[model samples]
Target: MQDEGISRARFLAAGLAGAAGALLPAGSAAAKERWGLSYRGVCYEVTDGETAETGWNATRMRTDIRAIKDRLHADSVSVFGDGAGRLKATATEAAERGLHVWLQPRLADRPPHEILDHLAETGRHAERLRRQGARVHLSVGCEFVLFVPGIVPGADAVERIRNLMSGNYDPQQMMRRLTAFIAQAAKVGRSVFHGPLTYGAAEGDEVDWRLFDLVSVNYYSYFQDPARHVRELRKYQRRHKPVVVSEFGSCTYKGAPQKGGMGWDVVDYDKPKPEIKGHLVRSERTQAAYLTGLLDVFEAMGLYAAMTYNFVTPDAPHRRDPRYDLDMAGYSIVKTIWGTENDPTSHWHWQPKEAFHALARHYARPHRRLDPA
Candidate 1:
């Protein structure tokens, strides 16, 4: 499933049992750490805040970026968020640590000009990072049909999603409009950033390959066979460019593997209180297995990079009551909580789900060798 319309919820704290050691054997022999973790959770509302991670705290961000490089062992990170200033702040932290930075501008539910303006502004900052000797890639934007305006007749992403679900729009027309916008975006990016340019596409988006320096897709193996999904990579391979799966993973629940990419849908945001829609068992191992299994397949398929869905979602923190638990519906690897909840004396604000250790081990292996594309 694509990241068509993920409901944005403002939240995060609570506690639950997680299998920090229940790791399934990888689908194939463990390969080295070519994987990059996408940091999609930093949402600073013009305030200061840590794994002790509320928002834009200098000390807290240092720890977060360090964990991505040192703990997760990721060599690159795709940093994105609501504001360009915050996104740049996060990306700058990642860049200083000797990690490749994919500076992605993700301004959702905004007008087209605002989104483009964000990209151009962010691109200039990314170029400076590159010129300063940091490896930076300017990802124009992502999932345009849902995020960008005019592609569909809706004021925002959620409305566009509902309208599309009613199946009343023309597919060809949607792509035609999206394709033109992407072209314009690429042009805008080139005007400000002079490094590699790519745009995040959904698994099935027919973006013109010529417009990107690399082929990027949010390939969530949602209810789909990993092998079948890898087979679908052939068409992308035909593009003769690096193929990067920018967004891929499972939710933290017993049956989340079968739900579509928007599996977090189980949480009902409509109610006054955050509540799980039905009975559900929390299983961090399920999320871990789904990710490890995909890493094995992606390694074997020689994909350039398989960045995970996200590092942490502080807005959707863990909770003790399943009815109130928001982390189960999040795609992050860590369970965020109120800092004081962990320990009144401790600064740590999160607990690792089973996937955390699994990924650390997977990425710590000997370097993987790939055949030329």
Candidate 2:
């Protein structure tokens, strides 16, 4: 029975693709490019103290935002936060510089009513921004797949899957909530978009294609090789959805040992104490290679938009905390606090690694095509 169901779903997807392809012209100009960078909007998780605080000083944060606007020639900026004031301020700043703003508030753990209340508040704020002649985009949550277990535990997996397929609670409920939210916001005159937690090109069971205008996918290359990564994105395009590489960056430092406690070194207490050096410096060339190759794939696939992982970090010193520190070891686009004077080739610095220059030039003059021959 499960095999038959799987085969039916594949047939439906293929039929949908054929119908849509027949309706559209071949190689029509792809969707407009809307590219930007992702980072802590207002809050940064401090490594030394293990506390979340505003990541950048007002002046530096504004400057950093402007730098991204200038460098990427982005059509818009996206920030993650739930506060109306913060979203309004970000929208104003980006609008002043002729950029749109997308907000992805954290709503995964909240109760359904609370989530609705938050979305109502966001809709109100987005409407206000629209009144002020600013473009604002709102997303319900980020990576809701990670929340499925919370909503539907392991014990209820079969029951939950049945309910989801029967249009009882999962996607059907999500669509109803989103439709109500969108209708209310539309009354106040605001345009909206949805950014779901997408893994590769495979749209999860929870995504209702009709709920969103633009399909947003976040890609992180922690476990997959480059070829597999590109193949995943190609599958996503086959669905006839305009795609966005919402988050992408590679870690070069693979937890090795270093001679001196220099640069951004954090001791992982949980690991075996055999001097685990980070992959930061060791991964610069690999990181650059990945970016170059990924960009080529994205362009060839005619992806709508792509945003790199981050822009800047807070002034806090790198310490024992794993999340930011582990990422700092190799994931940064600019060196800022993570790079050492000794390691001029560090992936974190302003000096463009091969990947940095490759992208900068690609975005600057995208008309030139590189022949595989």
Candidate 3:
């Protein structure tokens, strides 16, 4: 009886192996697609009031956009604003220049249905651009999970906070809202994208993988180490979906040894004193190294698309606002190395540092293909 059982097990194992061989497709379908860098784009956040003041001064923003475009040959731009009219005008201008646009409409605290309506209105504007042959991408929301204490300050603060911190938002509810918006946008024949804050791996909870054409993450080097950043990207790639570094930047002002300031203090509204540290000035170099390293890894992994944190300087004044003060003052390659500022004669005008040239060189022309594997 034992000898008969052993022979039967051997026969079953052989048959299973033969079945698997027959099921395997030729060369695993050849991947069907290859991932490559999307043209580097800038993330421009124009607040509601500022757009009103600036009106249609395309030259105001366009000059900076063109400058970066000339430097990097970028054909894409991402702009987010609260005003529907302003967003439309900006998208039109960008499209006319043959630049792809990603429009992020600001919606917070509105009921899901209301948010869906706003997206429909915005999608209609984007569809106009698409009809004219512009590559317009719409992100449902920007960092929707991050609950500003005051914006939604109420009895539900604790729950909202927990939901954000612990990734506790109901995935099904979030997915339903996003899918509704996506369905509305699809009616206008426009493509939609989602941008999530990439603080940790779980930050992507709000996105429904099947709903969008691409998955995007806004990651800044402020909180996590470079290795962790790459690891997170690898995990996303394993899902066979492309990833975008929607935002990336580091603080230039070296703060007190232990309390690293986030370049800006949201609560105090004051810039922290610049504690000169060895690492502060070299941040651009660090940024360049990290960026290049990620690009190398991404290319090798066959990943798609990456966009740096920003191109132009912020409108905030220096020495007063801690967050933008140090960063707008310190980490910038153009500000630190070039000795140029938005105002050349002002004290804010500091020379550019080595990191500026490092970026200029790296992005001046495409480097060798990245192959981490």
Candidate 4:
């Protein structure tokens, strides 16, 4: 699932000073509303389809949504991908199931107009969902500099990333374009969407928080200095808006936690067929420990929400062949399996990985009040 960061209007009061005591853990019941998951059920136009996450089945989506609420016990979900209709359906389903909806419409590598048009449609639908008694927030977009155009070179995110690494592009100019685009997105989104608005930002996006209602960052921390994660988060603190970690997770391989967001770099795309570039040991426990440790960080930080990168990546099916298996590069908590008709009672084709069980246990724990004493 494609997930972004969360803002805590759902739980935040006037300011952090007033909000801090309530949000910090003292062991009552999770403050009861911070856990969330990313649903990558519909990334409309992924380049090369590196991820197999965009398998949209209503039954499966609903089941996954239910699991986020019922099984994983997530308080909310950030919906990613394109197609206004699909976004509406998935978000509505999640909302009706009583999970808060972070309605993020990811129209990747499209013209700016197309992207905005998608946001307009999704915003209207989100507004409708909110009016219909659902807790909904519209994330204008995610990673404009990477996904949207004119910031850097290249047609898709991959090319842009490569181009960015080459240092041929101008950073100041890129930020200028990105910052402006985000402002326009916020303005356009606000016209149709009459609720709290958030933008799913990269760690270094430098987004103007004033344009948004809350701060939502897709932060994947390399496990070098865990305390440094806390310091970086505090930088985003606004007087009232709650800061959230939108996306964070590791690939199911050893030492992935140290690489953070770059964990996916292990894949050898240059090969005729995709495979691990080198000998890498698969360790689900490494991913599990990394994820749980961050959850602890978020919990301790009293964040608005901490949404792991995703629930499942269906395109990247788990294979016994380590060289062929795509799940090793994914951040999904569940490993995708193939089988529908064979299983009479299930619409989903996934097995719980170590991270899933670990998260379930973490989420199921009692959270204390996030309200001031």
Candidate 5:
């Protein structure tokens, strides 16, 4: 889901840290507390009303959450989407499996300049999850500069973002309005949800850090110099609250890193309906390499957490036909194959990609701070 970042005082108050030698590959001494994966279940907002044959089966959600913990070795999972039922199922499953959950309520398609209602709903969800004995952080929203209606000029989120990035709008004026909205939302969030709250902002978007508890940024900036990512993250680090790299991952295609956050949008995905037709070639190695580089940078920088763009994309599944392999444009670490029922080796209608293993290795390292018992 397009939710914001994460920060929790209780997580810090506990003096938590990854186990000794678990911070990073040998030679890195930084203590990172959260290593998370963005697990996107089937949500109507993401599918755009394509739920007839696509959705996350609750029966398999628990198993998937377990795999995210055992296979990915991640301590946290950010459950994205707007479906309250799905979010509860995902978060409850993740919590049962001992994974901290950052529940992000997506507000896509909703009018911008008006998020108080969304915030209220999120607060209710967060409160319910916390009362159920789950460690939860509510991400109010994400990248409003582009997704919100009034913030940018366009019919939809895609059109709005494209217009804003086209360099025609007055950025200073837009930022002022965006920050004002966020501040108001934060006030509303504080009323209902008595826990960590944050907003996910895209890189280059100006956010008033003083308004939120955590300095979160949806940084898909691998296209630029690695130093640039560090510089941007450091600006958040100066805020004293946890700095979360809320979203970052590459599509399963060559040169996807060059597109960064827009990897999914770079390819035209509408003509064939559910099936995407594009010129980009799939390359699991490229996806793995891009993710590994970001993991290294995040570990070395000693940030609070870095959640990979996503763990699964049920709507964008793999297909035998090259033309139907729309998953190449997706950020899921695993490619879901719809008709894998006959394959005993298939893990719940999905196949893990190379990036999955690479991330597993990176997260498998021994760290006392992140996994403190």
Candidate 6:
């Protein structure tokens, strides 16, 4: 019988051999090194509050951006905004940190029919950030099939999400609709903001690469075979264009590695503050291991950039009681706790998991030489 357990590094590299045919020419190693860590970043989130006063957190937001640059060692940051105001606030601060900003406008409660309006608003923010001497790339939207309307046949986001989950829609049809929307979004984004533009394609979504400056994908390709996923990603590095992993991460749980992309929905949101209540086990190392494996693949693959799913989660806080342990549902590297003020700027209010150090270390290493594309 074959040995069932594989070392993390080998496990990540195992699938690359099959991808050799798809890689950039071996002479492109110098180019890959020159483009090292193109977007070493994290997704920073900001949502509109019920009211203006409570809608944003300026103090904490400032602190988070500082920490993202100083502590997290991120050179690029993706500010995920719900509306124009939120995007401006987050992206402006990210710019202040001397990090390139990928300004993305999001619509959580709304339908896909409003994507054009939302992208228009985001373009305004992108222009504003650019005017302020900030390096900003306008990412018009993310995962439209799940977030937007009309692409998947649901009347609203919830219905469409359920439709997707139920496997009740046609995949090919869904792709066509999604492609059309992405192309439209790119067109709209270009009209307002004449800068680098991209759309965060959901993993496994076949996108038209010619429409955008960067080929970005939100890759959470399960936990079983990373090499195979890297090979798949390698195929997308066509036209000598940069391929970016816009978002990829796992949660902090014992079985999170196996949950893959489903980890986010594994816990019920409305059930309670800490949706997962039980004699639950927390696995910081599991999160770290999964990340390290992916980073290994990313480094060897000579991808342009990779932004982890997120940086902080003020919404998800840690708790002593298992019933209130919302951090279990978070993708944040730091586990924050509400009402626990450390009185000043410190990583104390939030606890950094093992993955935090692993990321810092991986990023700090010299860029690996990669095959030329």
For model 4, the run of ten residues with the poorest summed lDDT? 1-10
lDDT on C-alpha atoms for all candidate structures: 0.70, 0.44, 0.47, 0.71, 0.66, 0.71
lDDT of 4: 0.71
- Best candidate, TM-score-wise? 6
Would you estimate the TM-scores of all the predictions?
Answer: 0.82, 0.58, 0.62, 0.83, 0.79, 0.84
lDDT tens per residue, model 3, 1-373: 3223212322232343333233333343213233335545556655442223323345555655565556545556776655677677777777777776776665456554565566657667776777777777666655543322222222343456655456656656655644444445433324322222111112454445554555666654322222343455554554445556555543343331112223433223332533322333323444444444444434333444565544444333243333334443333434422123233222232233444455555455653332222
Q: Rank the candidates by lDDT, best first.
A: 4, 6, 1, 5, 3, 2
Superposed model 3: Cα runs more than 4 Å off: 1-36, 49-57, 109-114, 147-206, 221-230, 254-267, 270-283, 318-324, 328-357, 366-373
- TM-score of model 2 (CA atoms): 0.58
Displacement of residue 214 (Cα, Å) in model 5 is 1.3
Ranking by TM-score: 6, 4, 1, 5, 3, 2
lDDT of 6 at 325: 69
Q: After superposition, how far is residue 138 of candidate 6 from its true place, in Å?
A: 1.2
Q: Give lDDT tens digits, candidate 5, residues 72-189.
A: 8887788777666676667777778877777676766676544567657767877887888877777787777765667767777778877777876777778787887777777777
CA shift of 112, model 3, Å: 4.5
RMSD of each: 9.2, 11.8, 12.9, 7.5, 8.2, 4.6
Which consecutive 10 residues in model 2 have the weakest lDDT in total?
Answer: 40-49
lDDT per residue, candidate 2, 1-373, as tens digits?
A: 3222212222232333343343334564332231222211111111111222323234444665676567654554566544545555555666677665655554434454565565556656655666677655555544443322334332343454455556555555554544454344333222332222222121343345444545566655422233344455554555565666655554434321121112233434466432334433344455545555455445544565566544433332232343434434544455444344222122332333344554555556534222111
**Weakest 10 consecutive residues of candidate 6 by summed lDDT:** 1-10
lDDT for each residue of candidate 6 in 252-356, tens digit (9 for 90 to 100): 877665666767554565762336745557767777777777776675666778888777766566777655666776787888755553112233256677878
What TM-score should be assigned to candidate 6?
Answer: 0.84
Where is model 4 more than 4 Å wrong at Cα?
1-54, 339-348, 368-373
Q: What is the lDDT of residue 248 in candidate 3?
A: 51
